[model samples]
Target: MKQALQLLVLIFSLTVFGQNGNTDTAQVVIPGRYNSVEAQAKPYVIMISADGFRYDYAKKYHAENLLKYSNEGTQAKAMLPSYPSITFPNHWSLITGLYPAHHGLIDNYFYDYKRKEPYAKSNKKNAEDGTWYGGLPLWGLAEKQGMLSASVMWVGSASDAGGARPTYYYPYHEKFSPEEKVNKVIDWLRLPMDRRPHFISLYFPEADANGHHFGPDSKETEEAVHKIDQAVGQLVQKVKELGLKNVNFVFVSDHGMIKADNENPLEIPQLLLDKNRFDIYNSQTLLRVYVKNPDEVKKVYKELKANKTGGYKIYLDKKFPGSLHFSTKDDRYSRIGQILLFPEAPRIFLEKGEKSTAGKHGYSPKTVPEMKATFYAWGSAFKRNITINEFENVNVYPLVAHILGLKINGPVDGKLKVLKETLK
Candidate 1:
């Protein structure tokens, strides 16, 4: 009976995998790389990102494992996601230590006036193309310094950002179960010291998917949180069994979630719909408007300001609030639109007849507490029983680099001073 039940479970898992279609399960290896003598002697870090894991999800859902682990190590009140807290931008920011505007992935979807093309997260070619990315990610930074790295699935890992990819990596996909992912990490760590990755990244999308489909407060979202927590426990236990004393874990999330006002969704102003005047990219909480003629900026800005509703605010690119670091001065790639629209929480801009999801994000974290992400570190590298105040996500890059002894090649927004106290 036990064997029969096991077979039934295997069949069910295969059926679910088939539904997701054929995904590349093979690991992509870049040969002829080894950790430097100094790096091999340094500690290992396995940074995991659980997409859309809200700041309070663990405690709210009573995720026993995460709560215990964080209590034993370091926990933050909250991690502030960069402005326009969407997945692609925030993930890249976390990895590269640059603000979204500075890193050039200003939004998940936006038109690049210079390239005369649109960058959509759903476009495989655009996502994998290294030229679209800026700044050296953690993996690339490690590899450049003669240390090996790997990634299960990270935002920019698939792309050859910073002129190199992780020595071992898998392109973004959802076919791998949490157990499979943890096992993959174990396998990487089990390899010979010369070939094993010193810096590794793991990603999970369950919580985000559930939050968007069933709302942040739904039982489905809670279950997803619990699953992630359990996976963390499993990974930690497996590492302990391997007797890897130097391995450290840093768990984080790109952003949080909030229930949107789906029933009374905000409508796009008619002026934005005029193709002759503007090209628009809409992400519900934030809207980017590109003006065709430079001279028409003031005219359209004036008109939109008069027609603005209560749920959203419109701003000219040059006049964007400096605190958000999304203004013209901060746009390193000139990717930000001429005009912007920011929707308040619980209100999203949706077109007529288009359905809205129960949960949404992408608001400035300063304005909406719900947009704050999570940060929990529990490993030999971190201090124990320490809880720090809120800090921006950019600071995380330096903290990881410090632990692994990888030097930042250039100036990044993240400063080690902000998070150095968390470490021993």
Candidate 2:
């Protein structure tokens, strides 16, 4: 009877596993690239993203601790965010180290042609769906490599990427205060040594929302900035108090915020009549027009080009500027709009009447300083008192992988050499 019960348990587990409709059905094998290595004496990594924190925020608000952090560890003056430098795309880029295009998340709100479902932050079902998300997320990567990770309100952390999530992750929530977030991270760290996660991700978004409402340069924005800085300070103090060594902490942001040019805004819906003409997920800073009907691609292209009244430029999918790297080269992942409409920087588009918000991102990183992000890492793994110049955000993936000694089965857009200077 005991043997029969054990056999039944095994069968139950198998049945449950088989019922999970993971996008990648194959059993994951840790690839050769991520070879097993001598585990470090102390291996703890923390990644905190202050949503909408610009590279210059440290300077603008005189965030003393953050500035001192820059001085004490490796600091990148500005981390260039991926094109369409907005919230979700840039946040995912930091972890996966793949551009939004490569990751199959072209924009914050896009329609999944395959699933016939909409991908939006508010849609819990879509947010948790693995079919809409592609590539290996860092949390899932840690799970595969026998390490543990935790995320507190980080984008994509809640999602079922390839049917895997962090060992511990809470779905995105706005009610959690900055202090609560810091305390929760400490709680995770204080777990029994054997159970503690080796990696943790935390996110604070008050700054982003504040910036959107009051503009990046507003005094209201400063309040959010001050609050986030205080939270950072509190986080460091808690770690020091805990006396945990061999820990690495990385401070980053998805993208910066800029004042919107609401004075002379171009209304997209007014400019084009066909609202349902292709699932055009339009935003203030950018527009991603994914065609519902393949035949309409040509018609849409002609309509966009003739709209000389607008301040945006339209490009064929293949003709977008190479520097932006906003489209995928691989045929397997090529699902971006056949007709790309790129609005010039600072100036923005509106679905209806003028200014969408006081400020925004999702503009060309090249032209807008606000679109640039920040990267400052200080810990056991990073060398002290180093200041590096600007670099693209995609390289961050290899940096995290190198610190953890993780390997991937396939090529990642981020190269390890670019981040070699950052290691101790």
Candidate 3:
């Protein structure tokens, strides 16, 4: 009877194994020029993105301790963000090497063309439908390569989309403190050698938070950077303490911030405000409207196109003028608004009952220098003491893949030049 039971168990196990074997398909490997069996055997990677950090602040202040990695190792003068220069879209691009269209996260605010409901940035339930984010993030790629990854707080990281969940994830929790974020990273690093992640992102949006509250130039913003600097110090200390050698670290930000006075000088004159013509998303800077019946989107487009007072630009959904250094026209991502009103100077976009205190960024990337994010790379593989200029954030995906010895799928908007020379 015992032998019979054993035989029966064996058959059951075999049947179960065979039945579910194909259910969890193997990860599809997308080959690339950079992808090779040899490239996959390099030192591991540690990527950190601090949202809303500016390049000038690091270059000028020198307070960013980790940013020194950019100078001492391989660095870029500034990282040009995707066209809109907002948080969600640009952060998604940095990881996927694809624009908002290709990666599929069009904006921080979701627009349901069907008008199902307003897409809020922090809404997790609605975000689960898969439209909130697009493409696979770097962490997913690392996991597929048979490596481990951990994301503490990165945009589009909170969800376990496409069954592409990280080995460890600390999704956006409002109650999480900075110390909690830092400690969680240290804990993840301390996991047994086999369990610890090889890819990680450490983010602190306090600077951007302060920028929105106290303006980028204000003391509060500076203090926020100082606090984050200490956070960086703690992270490096833990890395050393945990003995995570052979790890490559890349520190970056989504975009920079602009100083705003909150006063609206370019308020649309009553004559310009056709109740039927304008759906003012931002009466000051970002203006969106559905023109009156019989009025062409282009007619309103032509009017805004000609008016350049507030540093605004008008583009039909099809035409985003200039080589804004992004694949914005791609059909995969969210196309920017029909008319984009970029602010020229210190102006804030105002809404009903909304009060602006400090700095703002949703304007044209060209108009806001702060919209330019920061980039720095160091550790086992990066070359030392070099400064390259105006590296597009899109390019980072390929560069990172090269560093980690992974391959990217799909057509990439970023190139793998300039910075390639920096790596030894």
For residue 385, model 2's alpha carbon misses the true position, in angstroms, by: 1.4
Q: How well is each residue in 1-424 modelled by candidate 2, as lDDT tens digits?
A: 2222112211201011112233332212222222123432437889999888999998899988888887898999899998778777788878888888878776666655565555655555666676777778777777677676788877777677855677677666554689988988898788766556777899988778888888999998898889998999999999989998888889999899888787887666443445455555565566656666778777767776776566887777767777888754632355566766677777876644323678778887888887898899998999899988888888988888778767766567788889789888
TM-score of predicted model 1?
Answer: 0.94
Of the two candidates 1 and 3, the one with more favorable TM-score, higher being better, is 1
Best by TM-score: 1
Clashing pairs in 3: 100-333, 101-332, 101-333, 215-358, 256-370, 279-289, 311-342, 312-342
Measured against the true structure, the TM-scores of the candidates, in listed sequence, are 0.94, 0.86, 0.81
Q: What tens digits encode model 3's per-residue C-alpha lDDT throughout 317-344?
A: 5565555533335645333445555556
lDDT of each: 0.87, 0.73, 0.64
Question: Which stretches in model 3 have alpha-carbon errors above 4 Å?
Answer: 1-42, 114-117, 127-129, 268-280, 283-285, 290-295, 303-311, 325-328, 331-335
Better of 1 and 3 by lDDT: 1
Cα lDDT tens digits for candidate 1, 298-345: 999999999887988989999999988999999999998899998878
Clashing pairs in 1: none
Candidate with more favorable, higher lDDT: 2 or 3: 2
Ranking by lDDT: 1, 2, 3
Off by over 4 Å in 2: 1-42, 269-271, 275-277, 291-300, 328-335, 353-355
